[model samples]
Target chain A: MKILCNKADLLKGVSTVSKAVPSKTTMPILECILIDATSAVIKLTANDMDLGIQTEIKGTIVEKGMIAIDAKIFSEIVRKLPDSEISIETNDNLQTTITCEKAKFDLAGKSADEFSFLPKIEKDVSINISEFTLKEVIRQTLFSIADNETNKLMTGELFEFSGSTLRVVSLDGHRISIRKIELKEDVESKKLVVPGKTLSDITKIVSGEIDKDVVLSYTNNHIVFEFDNTTVVSRLIEGDYFKIDQMLSNDYETKVKINKREFLNSIDRATLFVKEGDKKPIILDIGEEAIELKIKSQIGSMDESINIEKEGKDLMIGFNPKFLIDALRVIDEDEVTLYLMNAKAPCFIKDEKENYIYLILPVNFNVGA
Target chain B: MKILCNKADLLKGVSTVSKAVPSKTTMPILECILIDATSAVIKLTANDMDLGIQTEIKGTIVEKGMIAIDAKIFSEIVRKLPDSEISIETNDNLQTTITCEKAKFDLAGKSADEFSFLPKIEKDVSINISEFTLKEVIRQTLFSIADNETNKLMTGELFEFSGSTLRVVSLDGHRISIRKIELKEDVESKKLVVPGKTLSDITKIVSGEIDKDVVLSYTNNHIVFEFDNTTVVSRLIEGDYFKIDQMLSNDYETKVKINKREFLNSIDRATLFVKEGDKKPIILDIGEEAIELKIKSQIGSMDESINIEKEGKDLMIGFNPKFLIDALRVIDEDEVTLYLMNAKAPCFIKDEKENYIYLILPVNFNVGA
Candidate 1:
């Protein structure tokens, strides 16, 4: 295969597909990217059985042929090449030569016919959402996904769609995060559990342009996201997601509205007294017009207060500072509301429209202490 | 110890002394910073036997006392404290209370008597140099220090001062780097091998202001650097340094002058074709007008030529591109002269006044190939 492309164009294409290239696998072919030049434009494809990425190169095609080259080496070479036109040619013996400006790299390649291609999934149910909205929802909720592989279901985020609304949810054992967005068009009801790894990678590829929309399709076993010149295919986890609705409730004995920045800063300061392996609990005392934060440990103790608009009864609760900080940081609003049923029950931080919600389990503590 | 200090001032003092606090050590006292408030000014010191740093904290001493506290925790707490006046008080039991704004940290402290103090060094010989020059010389030569622990002497830089001249030299097995500077004042002649670790850490504390000079003193086995309210004491390596003078010679069969940026960039691009465990030699064919760089590997081959002013017979030599790149990147000159003796002898990159010299050993390559 002979193709001439700009160095920048080739680097972009290689990097997009490289996200799916496996660093180590029993099948060596999975480490390579299949370079196909048969069509009007050159296509680069990478697959690791569970995830696949394909992107097109914007350059002239000299001849129609194909080859598979090591993704890591090829990408590095292209990235470091001078900013000029790059020529790539593959011979019948599977030897590839890449030339850019005054630099040339003749690398060993494998036959493209021996490589695995992404599965062809029939477009069953598809939805269109702005790339900006999708990326925002993923970033807001992906952090709560369980990192442990013991429970496969916990490693994925649930995407639930009904009527004209779509909701995304992620929950580890200690905390739960949920984001809801309104769709532009009505679509068939559908639910899919996507691996957190896949959602995070997609966030990297999607552009920040909110005007452009990403077309998403779900098949029986595979889901695809197509936008611009790139397409991503990821396997959907097959299992029942947790009954998250039952865990969330509107019943609360105390509700406090406080400035998001002030609350976040207070929690961050309290963490100073905490050391590695020291699970110190930060206590929050909700009063009539203010919320006080307290942390006592062998190293020291810290206390701070922030003015708040309170409703309902007063209560005190303790929580892991990191969990509270994580939930508050992702919130973009200036003011946030917190609902607490009691010291032992989980507390909820939600928006005015209920578009976003974060529930964190409180750590048990002696109220008198 | 009772003292009132600004948050920023305390943070700066803690960070400077924390550099000497060993991350992991058998001596527990080494993990603490001794705060002495006996004088009108408050002093903070940290020691790890081999090195010690002492700096004065900008604050008012309310009472005369002293205590030792964990360096890691104290630094973190001070850094996160609100931007306001902070008050620290230690009782007879060594329990300390650190209060800033609405936050308070009562940390456990140790007796100041248990902490090891920096030894008082009698000034035997002293030399004065601008902090800017001292920092510059260290940066230009420290990269060549041997990282391996097998040779204790090669891990330090040789500092030689005579008349109004100060020269620093560092040599590993593969390359040697040297820097020479003329001092403004006449100083006593002395020689010391300062550990690479000490030089690097000192670089962090010294400001780049050339107008200010750092007072340096050498005792029996200790070297002290005092500047800008901070003092650093380091134990000099007690051993003979490598004889690097015989290794650098002006006699050369080929001498070529080339643009430093172009030479460095070409070598960086040539490195793309080389992989881990593959020490591919980059061959340089020097001619009358230009120098051709070529690299042939199992993966591929690369060749480029750059314009140069040559003065000797045509010659071919090979070197590890990384070593050449390292020395060239640090050079501030627009054009650099290279002196080559032969294909096997070490090549030298130096200035006209011999203020800076870098000798790199060429990798053995097949001249006929």
Candidate 2:
């Protein structure tokens, strides 16, 4: 295989595919990036069993062949090479030579036949969404996904499509975050669970352009995202997601509307007094005109209040400050409303239209302790 | 103790002194910052046995007293507080109350008497240098200091004052770095070995302003640096420094003048083939008009060349790419002259006036291996 490509173009393609390259693997071949010039465009692919990324770059194909090169070394060399034309050639013995200006590198490449290729997905059912909207939805819900594999479904987010609305939901037993977006076209009802790691990697690859659209195609076992000359394929988590609808409630005994920035800042400050790995909860006392936030730990205690417009009866509730902070940070509105059914029920932070809902379970705490 | 200060001012002072607070120490008092309001200026001090820092912040003293607060918690609280005047009050029982805007914190403070204080240095011998110049000299020579305590003196830098010239030298056994600067006013000849950690911390505190001067005062055992309303006191390493004069040679059989940036870039690219903890050397083959750099490792091999203006007979030498890259990175010259005697002798990177000299010992290598 022989090809001549610009350093900038090659580096970008290498970096895009490198996201799926496993850092440590039992099979050494999984660490290699297959470079194929047989097609009109040079394609670079890296697969790590669960996730795979393939990107193409513009280059002149001197000879049509393929070779798998170590992703780490190839990327590093291309990154540091001069911003000029780079010539990559591979011999029959899989010895690849890279040359740019006055610098030259000779590396041992593995046979491309031994490399694992991404599973081809049949593009039967597909949906088109703007990159900006897709990235925003992922960012708003990805944080709530469970990091551990104890509950396989909790480690993945549920993507449900019905009518003209696409609803994304993620939870980790403690809290549930749901976001609903209007789709441009109507589609049949469908649901799939996507691993959090895959979505995290996809976010990095998308440019988040409002005009550019990403085509998402999914099969029974695999899902594919195609945009900007790059394609990402990830295996779907095979499990039924938790029925979060039962956990969400619309009835409330007390409701309050407060400035999002002020509430976020107060909760953030309260977090300073809570040490890591501690179960200290921030107690909120909703009164007539303001909500007093309190927390007491071994090191210190913090008490802060934010003015709020309240209705119904006043109530006191305790919650993990991190859950409240996470929901408030993603909200871009000037003010957010909070609804509480009672001290034992979960508190809901959502708009009247229910475009977004964040339900946080309350923790039992000694009042006025 | 009671004081009202702007949140920004308090945060700055806390951060400045927190550098001296050890992360883990047997003496808990060393992890606290003593807030002394007994004097006219509100001072915050932190000591870690070997190094101590004290800084004064502008604040109105409501009541004249002193208290000690945990550095980590105090800094975090002050950092998150609102940008307004913060009132800090301490009761007789060492319960400190800090209030800013609508937020308040009650922290347990330690006894001020238990906190360690910085050693007072008599300002009999002092030198005034612009913060920019001092910071530059330290940056240029600090990289050569040995990190390990195997050799007590090698872990420090020699600051020698002779007439109007102030020469600084530091070396690890393989290479030596020397930098000389002309002082504004003539002073008596003196010598002091300042610990690398002290100089490192001083660099972060200094603003590097050309108009601002940092007053450095030295005693028999301590060195004090006062600048920008901040004073840092550190214990100096006591021992005779190595005599690097013999290692620097003026004689040479082959000489080459090359662009500092180009040579540095070529050597840096060659470093890609070298693995961590590997002792692979970059071989330089000086020819009539260019120098070719070559390196071979188990992973791969790299060969690069840079055009140079050469003199005398051709010669080949090898050196650890890191040693050469370190010196080249710190030097500000566009073109540097290299003086080489033979493959066994050291290479000198300096000029005619010898304002800056870097002596690097070459490593033996097989010519065509």
Candidate 3:
């Protein structure tokens, strides 16, 4: 294949597909990126057995051909080349030469036919969402997913789409996070399970203001994201997701609006005395005007209080401080409201700026009646 | 011990000494920070046997006494308290009570007498040097020290202060870095081996303009640094330091000047190929007016040439690319100049910003050849 590409355009095109290239795989072709040059454009593709990525960029193509060169070496060389036009060509002997300025690299490449053919995204059921909203939703709900292999269903985030709203839910049995975003584009309803790494990579690439729109489409077993002239396709994790709606609270015994920063700091301090006993639980003693958090361990005990205008009858509840604090951090507002049912029920936390909610399971206090 | 201190002041004092506190030591006293309150100051001291740190903050003294509390617990509590005046008092039963606004922490304390005190520096012969200069010199030279404990002397940076110049030298046989600073302070000359961590911590805390000063004091077997209300004392590694002067170059057979950014980027790209070859060394073919960098492995081969104006004959040298890249990073100049004698001999790199030199010893590339 013969083609000419600008340094910036070439590097960006290669990097998009390089993430799917296997750094250590038994099959040599999995570590290479297949480059196909047509009359109008050039496509770069890389894939492991489970996931694949393909991106095409405009190039001055002199001849139409294909080859698979080592992704890591080619990417590194292209990334560090001086900002100028680069020329790449493949000889009939299966040797590829990449030349930029006065530097040149000749690498042995495999036949393009040896590469795994990636699945084509032929469906237009794609939906558009603001990049900022999608990234925030992932960050708010992703960390709570289980990281163990024993529970296959718990290792992925559950996504449900219905009535122009995309709902994302993640739970590890200890804590649950739910986020909702209104779809801006017309589309059919769908449901899918996204692996933990897919959510992490999505957040990594999507940040800042939502200047760019996000396009998402899914097949029977894979989901594809097309944004910023790059395409990333990942295999959907298949399992029976939990019905988290059953865990939501239906009654609220007490609710308080307090400064988010103050509550987080107080809970962090109270967590110090919890020494992971048979069951580590921090007790919150609520009064008319203030809430005191208390915990005792072998090393010491602590009592810290924050002021809030409590309205209901004074209540006491026991909770795992870490779970409570984790939920608190997802809120990016000056003031956050907490809805509690009782000492043994799940607690709900939410912020005004976001359409997200966090539910924390309480620990059994067993306080003498 | 009883004292009243600003929340910020107490937190800063505790963090400085707390860095040396042992996370898990067999001796319980070693895991605690000794807190002593006198007429108008509260001193915090912590040690992990190998290194000791002491810092004092001015506060209102309510009672005169001494006690040791768990370092991490106390620091965490103080860091979370409101930005108000914090008062700490000890009860008759030796329970230290910390109060800040509405928060309270009760922690068990051990007697300070059980802690082992480190040797103090003689107060007479302290030398004052520019804090910024000392910090810069340490940053340039300390990167060459070996991290593994296989070599006793190589694990520490040798500090030699004589006449008006303070010289820091470190080497791991494969590479050597030397930095010098001429100070106006007049004091007795001394040579001491300070642990690598001490230099790292000092650099972390000392940063300003080029004229601010820092003091250093030394005893028979320890070095003490006193600056910005923080005192770090470190045990010395006992041995006769190698003579670094004999390693400096008096004349060069050839000299080459190149743009610092260009050379750095080129070497960084070449490092990828070298790193792929079982961590093998890359060869530099230096000739009339250019240098060729070549790396070959079982997978493939890479060859790149960089143009350089030269005055000597052609030669070849083999060395690890990582060593050269590290030495190049510490340089803060637009242009870098290198002096070479032979391919087998050591090469010296000099930057135009300051009176510093780096010597990297080339590997014996052809031992089996």
Candidate 4:
């Protein structure tokens, strides 16, 4: 096989797919990226068994063949090559030669037949979603996914689609984050549990454009996302998600609208007293016109107050400051409404249109204190 | 002790001294920073027995006393405090209270007497040099210091002062780097070995300014550098440095002049084929008008020719590209001169003024191949 490619184009193509290459694996082929030049366009593919990425490089093709080379070495060589046309050729012995300007590299490559290929979807059912909306929804809910490998179900996010609305839910026992977006067209209803790792990679590939849309398709056990000149296929986790609707309640005894920036700053200041291993709780004491945040630790104690617009009866609650800060930072609203039933019940921070909801369980604290 | 200081001033003072705090030590006092509020100025000091740093913070002192607090915690707290006047008060029990705007912290502290103080230096010899010159000389030679703990002598740089000239030399078995500067005034001759770690910290504290000067004083076993509002004291290593002068020679069989950027870029490109455990050698064939760099490894081979103006006999030598790149990157000259004896001898890269010199030993390569 022989191909001529621009230095910048080839480097970008390799970097886009190299993110899916496994750093360490028992199988040597898993550490390589497959280069296929059987058609008019060249394609670079990388797969780590559970996830796969494929991107195209615009170049001139002289012949047609396929081979797999080490992802790391190939990318490094392409990045350092002079900004000129690069010629690549592979022999029957799987020896690949890359030459650009006065630099040339002859790398040992493995046969392409031993590498795993991404499973193709049936494409019977599909949906179109704007790239901006999909990226925003994933960013809002991805942080709550459980990092602990012991719980397989919690490591994935639940994606439920009905009519023209798509809802994404993620929970890690301590808190739950939910984001909902309306698609451009109505489609068949479907639900899938996608691993957090796949969604994280997807966010990197999709450009935030209002007019561009991604074509999403799913089969029995695999899902695919196609946008621009790239395609991503990931295996879906097999398990039943939690019944998050039953755990959520609309009933509350008190509600207040507070400035998001002011609330975040108060919690950040109170968290300074918390040590590394200390699970100190920040208590919010709500009054008629102001809310006070207090933290007590072995090393020190801190207190801060911010004025808020309150309704109904005043209430007090104890929570992990990090959980609140994480949810508030992703929220793009100036003023947020918080609902609380009592100090022992979970509190909810949601938007007026109900597009996003964050529910945090309160820590147990002595009421007298 | 009671003092009212600006938040920015306190943060800067604490951060500057915190660099000397030992990350892990058996003695707890080594992990703390001493805070002394005496007379009209407030001072922060941190000493790890080997090195110490002290900086002043302007503040209003209501009471006079001293205490010690954890360096990491104190710096972090000061960084997060509100942008206003911060008031600090210490009780007889050593418990310190810090208040800024609407935030307050009560932290446990120990008596300042438990911490080690900076040793007083007897100024038998002193020198004045611009901060920029000192910083440049250190930066040019520090990279050659041996990181291996077994070689105590090679881990320090020799500072030899004689006849109004100061020369700094460092060698790590493979290569030697030397930087020299002439002082404005002639002074007493002195020689000392400073640890690489101490020079590293000094570089961080001193700003690169031509007008600002650092007063350097040396005693029997210690060196003190005083500049700006900060003072750093370091213990001298008790050993003799290598005889680098004997290894350097003014004789050469071949001499070449080439553009620094072109030579550096070629070496960088050749080094890409070298893996972590693989010590690939970059061979340079010096002719009358052009120089060719070639590398052969298990993965591939690369060869490139760069134009150069040469003198004397034609020669070929091999070297570890990293050492050459390190010295070339620090050179401020547009074109550099390279002197070579043979393939098995050391090569020198120096400037016209003879202020800086780099000697690199070549790796033996097969002559017939």
Candidate 5:
């Protein structure tokens, strides 16, 4: 398509759409990004059957035409080119010449008819949330989703929307992360299971600052997110998600409060000596004034202590050191509170000042009274 | 060994020796660094049978002893500990405790006697060169060494140490880089083949000012480099290396000088569309004033041209753009001189004023003239 656009804006638009470009496609056309010049806007679209991204940028339309070019090659050349004005010239011979300053890339183009259509958003249920908040919730919870295909439904993060709150739950049957954020606009309660990879890719393009309210919509088979000048559509998983609330605990027999940094460092040291196989548990010996962490592996062992502001009956419990380290790193407050329900069962971990809770599925370890 | 060492010094020593420690070892003790404590100095050594590194640091020997610990674990713990005095205490049972600040790591230790002896210098002939110049020569030539283990001898850099100069040569049978520097201290003629990995690791740990001199010594089985408080010894490749000089042309038929940046960038752009197959050949069509670069791939194609000042007849050569890029990147001069003897012969690339010569074997292109 014949159009004039700022190299920076073109690069951003191409980068967002290129994420959906097929890395390895059976069909050749799936790797091409279709560029169309309509009025004063240049629209770029890329699709890989299941996921698609389309973005538009303001540009001067010289000749209203369209062409599909290799998404990866075009994006890479655009990124390396100077930031001056980029003039794209497309001809009926199916060739696009991108010229910038002293650099020019004449890339053979595909016919516009070869480009596939993006998934159409049939029913759009709009919701408003700050881009930063959405990204924060996704970052904390999406990574915990099951990547193995054996658990097909677990490959996606389960999103539960009700009233004014948006809750995201992801678990690989081992570790679980649940994050909830209050939305600005209310929508009909709906549960959508979106693939982890697609959501993570979309988050990359969305800036932390919410330039505009993100409009979310769900069709019969796909979920679409429209924000700024870009739109991303991802397929949804169809399955009955587990009742996550039932896994939460209410009572604890013993509690300990310690500085998050101090506890994390102590647990990190203990993990060094925690070996693989049968007897690799890290013993947490709790006293009136401090907690001692020790782990003995086949090669040797490690022991570190952190001061704790507590007064209780001396107790000792064994656990996987990595679990405590992970929970400590995610705690939002300076001081982390660990609620040990006899240390034999799953322990509830959270910040002393925040509502966040991280439940560790504890391994069976000997606890000496 | 029980010793109190400066955390910084101990960390540096461990880190340096660990570079020679291969992660996967058929012989188990190769993964451990032998720590020897003496009255005035503490030495750490790690060897993988082929190469070894030893660094002696001054420390207070509480009790003179020797023991070996897992290099990876020791390095990890030492790296994370705060900058302070770290006491490495080994008991009668061989259990080692590394304590720094509030963090402690107790690792299983083995007798230091299990480790292999360090390679010794056998030849008296040596050359003393400035660390800066030696480092420069190594950096410029090491990348050309063949990485494949098909021929063990070609995997190392070939060195020629004569009365007043030190020359380094490396080739992958396709591309060869040669760098020569005048030695500061007079020495007898000596030749040694040092493994590329040893020279590369030495470059990473190299310190001191440009005026500092490093001693190089060689023997039948090993080449040892002693600098500052560290000594690096690599097993020399047995047998003779391929004669790289014979592969380079003594004179040029067609020579042209071009700006290093301009030529490098042009070739980089041409690489985008260059596909290696039974199809189109990447063409460098040189005219009277500029060079037009073109590549045609099955997916698409790319064409770019840059202007240059030339006084010779027009020439068109088809060579792999990657080899040209590699040669161009090593040139320290602002302008690069490209010499072509013929289409079938190798191309010699060098700076307009430097003795460093890069030889790139030309690939046969079907679009052959």
Candidate 6:
């Protein structure tokens, strides 16, 4: 394979595909990136059994061929090369040579026949969504997904489409995060559970441009995302997600409107008093004018008050500070409203438009302390 | 004890003294900071048997007393307090209360009698130097100090004062780094080896201002550095330093002058071909007008050439890329001169003013590779 391209263009393409490369694997060939110059554009692909990424760069193809090279070494060399044109060529024996202005590197490449190609998915059902909206929804919900594999379904997020609305939900048995967005065009209803690792990698690749749209096509077991001359194919998790509707409720006995920044800062300060690995909960005492936040541990105790607009009976509740902090950080609004049914029920934080909802369970604590 | 101080001032004092507090110790008292309000000024002190630091902050003292608190928790609390006047008070039972605008903390404090205090050093002999120059000299020589305690003296830097010059030297048996500066006034000749950890901590505290000066005083076993409103006392290593004078030479058979940045970049690019923990050396082929650098490893090989001005017979030498990169990164000259005697002898990198010198030993390699 022979190709001539700019350093910046080649580096960008290499980095985009490197996200799917496995760091350690039993088969050495899985760590290689296949470079194909058979077409007019140069394509680079990397697959790690579960996830695969491919990207194309504009270059002049002198010879039509393909070869696989070690991704780690190739990326490092291209990153440090001079800001000029780079020439890459492979010989009959698969000896690839890379040359720039005053630097030259000779590396041994493997046969392209030994590499595993991505599974081709039939594009029967597809949906189009802006990159900015897709990235935001993933960021807001991915954090709540379970990291361990004890519950296979909880390790992935549920993506459900009905009529014109797309709903995304993730939970870890302690809390649930749900986000909804309206689609530009109506499509057939479908549901799929995507692995958290795949969504996390996609967020890093997308540019988050409001005008650019990403086309997502899914089959029975595989899904494909196409945008910006790059394509990502990932296997879907095969399991039924938990029915979270039963865990949510609309009835509330208390409602409060408070400044997001003020509440976030107060809860963050109260967290400092809790020791590591300790399940000390932050107790909140809600009243007519303000809410008192308190936490006590073996080292110290902290107490602070924040003013809020409330219209309900006074109540006291305790919760894990991390769950509250995580939800508050992703919210872009200046003020957020909270709906509580009682001290034993889960608290709901959502917008008036029902765009996002975060439900957090309360922990039992000693009120006299 | 009772005192009122601004959040910024208290945080700065706590951070400065916290550097001396050991992370883990057999005696729990070593992890505490002593807050003394016996005098009009509020002082904070921390000691770890080997190093001790104390700093005073401006605050209004309402009561005269002292107590010790855990350094980690105190610093974290002070960092997150509101940006206003903070009142700190303690009861007879050593229960400390800290209050700000709307937040309050209650922490358990230990008796001040159990905390170790810094030993007072008599000002018998001292020297005054600008903070900028002192920091620069330390940065240029500290990287050569040995990290392991196999050689007691090599783990510290030699500080020698003679005539009108203050010379600092450090080495790890392979290479040596030397820096010299002229003092404002001549004093008694003295020699001491300051531990690397103490110098590292001092650098982080000093402001590095050209107009301000730091007074350094030493006795038989301890050295004291006083600057701004802080004082740092450290124990010196007791041993004889290595004899590096014999390792330096003024005679050379080959001389080359090259651009520091260009040479550094070329060597850095060549380093990409070397594997981790490998002893591969970069060979330099010095000609009349340019120097060619080449490296070969199990993975691949790289070759690059850089322009230079040579004034001696052609020679070939090999060296560990890290040693050369370290010396080049510290030198601030646009053009640096290299003096070489033979293929096996050490190389000298210095300036015409003789303010700094770096000696690097070359590695032996197969010439025909």
lDDT tens digits, residues B1-369, model 2? 999999999999999998899999988898899999998989999999899999999999999999999999999999999899999999999999999999999999999889878887878878888999999999999999999999989999999998988999999999999999988898879888999998998898899999999988889898899999999999999978787786777889999999998899889988998898989999999999999999999889998889999999899999999999999999999999999989989999997899999999999999868
User: Between prediction 3 and prediction 5, which has the larger DockQ?
Assistant: 3
Rate residue A78 of model 5 by lDDT.
84
lDDT of 1: 0.90
lDDT per residue as tens, model 4, B1-369:
998999999988888898799898999899999988875689999999889999988988889988899887788788877789999899989888888877777889988889898998777767999999999999999999999989888888999999989999999999999999999889788888998989998898788799999988888688899888889999988877777788989999999999998899889988887877778889999988889898888767778888999989899899999999999998989899999988898999998778999999999876554
Model 6: pairs clashing at backbone N, Cα or C within 3 Å: none
Off by over 4 Å in 1: A275-278, A366-369, B124-126, B296-300, B366-369
Tell me the DockQ of each model, to 2 decimals.
0.59, 0.90, 0.60, 0.57, 0.51, 0.77
Cα lDDT tens digits for candidate 5, A1-369: 688888889998998898998788888799988898854678999989889999998788888988888888898788777678999998879878998776667768899887788866776567777777777777777656777999888999888899887888887776667777778767789888898888898789888686556678887688888888888888888888878889877777678888888788777766656555554778888888888887776666677788887634566777777666765665567887777776567777765432456777666654431
What's the TM-score of each model vs. the native?
0.96, 0.99, 0.90, 0.95, 0.91, 0.97
Say which candidate scores most in lDDT. 2
* Cα lDDT tens digits for candidate 1, A31-82: 9999989888899999998999999889888988999998887888888777
Q: List the residue pairs that clash in candidate 5.
A: none
| DockQ-better candidate, 2 vs 5 | 2
- For the candidates in turn, chain A alone yields TM-scores of 0.97, 0.98, 0.88, 0.97, 0.90, 0.98
| Candidate with best DockQ | 2
Error of model 1, residue A45, in angstroms: 1.6
Write one digit per residue (lDDT tens) for candidate 6, span B157-183: 999999889999999887899999999
TM-score of chain B of each: 0.97, 0.98, 0.91, 0.97, 0.94, 0.98
CA error at residue A56 for candidate 5, angstroms: 1.6
lDDT of 4 at B189: 83
Candidate with more favorable, higher DockQ: 1 or 4: 1
Docking class of 4: medium
Q: In each prediction, how many residue pairs overlap at the backbone (N, C-alpha, C within less than 3 A)?
A: 0, 0, 0, 0, 0, 0
- The Cα error of candidate 2 at residue A211, in Å, is 0.7
Please identify model 6 stretches exceeding 4 Å from their true place: none
Better of 1 and 5 by lDDT: 1
DockQ of 1: 0.59
Task: Kindly report the TM-score of the first chain in candidate 4.
Answer: 0.97
